[model samples]
Target: VNLLFSANRWEMASEIVDDLNRGIVVVCDRYAFSGVAYSAAKGLDFAWCQAHDRGLPLPDSVFFMRVEPQVGALRANFGDERYEDVDMQVRVRERFDDPRLRQGVPWH
Candidate 1:
C-alpha cells in the first residue's frame, strides 16, 4: 500500500512540475511525506518508507499543521477511516518530525 501511495504520487509528478513550470501555484493536499508518515504509523520501518520514495521530486515547500492528538482524532472523525485513532496519530506525528523533512509552514 505504501508503494502504491508513492507510485500514485509519482504518477502525478509530471503534472505538478508542469504547473510549477507554468508559474501556476500547486497546493497538494497530501504528498510524499504522507506516505512515509502513514506507513510508519503502521509499524513499517521508517527507512524503508523513505527508501521507497528515493529519487522522487521534492516539493518546493510543504505545510504541516500540528494539532493535539485528541483534536486530530476528533477532526478525523475518528474511526471513519484507518489511522484515525489517537495512538496511531501519535506515531504518525512523531514520524512527521523526521529530520529529513524541511521546515513546514504553520496552519491552524
Candidate 2:
C-alpha cells in the first residue's frame, strides 16, 4: 500500500485526523511532534515546521521513547540508516534538549 512506503509523509497525519474525527481510534506511530522534532533537528525553522500541522487534534496522551544516542545509532546502523551517524545523532539529540525550545527562553 502507498501508506506503507510513505511512512514519514506528513499529509498522512491529516488523514489520520480525519479518521479520528469519524470515530476511529486512530493511533499514529509517529505524528506531528516527531516530524517537527526530526525536521527541526535538521535545522528547519521550528515554527515553520509546525505551521502545516496547526489545529490538528492533539493527542490525548504521549509516550516519549527516550533512548540513549549509542543505542539509537546501533539500531539505525543495523538498518543501514546514516542518521545514526554519531555526530549527526548528537546534533539531533541536542536539538531536542536545547533549552531555547522551552517556554520563557528568549530566541533573541
The numbered model that scores best in lDDT is 1
Residue 105, candidate 1: C-alpha displacement in angstroms: 11
Tens-digit lDDT string for candidate 2 (47-92): 7766665565567765556677778766634436645566666676
Model 1 — which ten-residue stretch has the worst lDDT?
A: 99-108
lDDT of each: 0.78, 0.60
Cα lDDT tens digits, model 1, 1-108, are: 999988888798888789889999888888778888889889888889888777766766676778888886666357788767888888888888877544343332
What are the candidates' C-alpha RMSDs? 2.8, 6.5
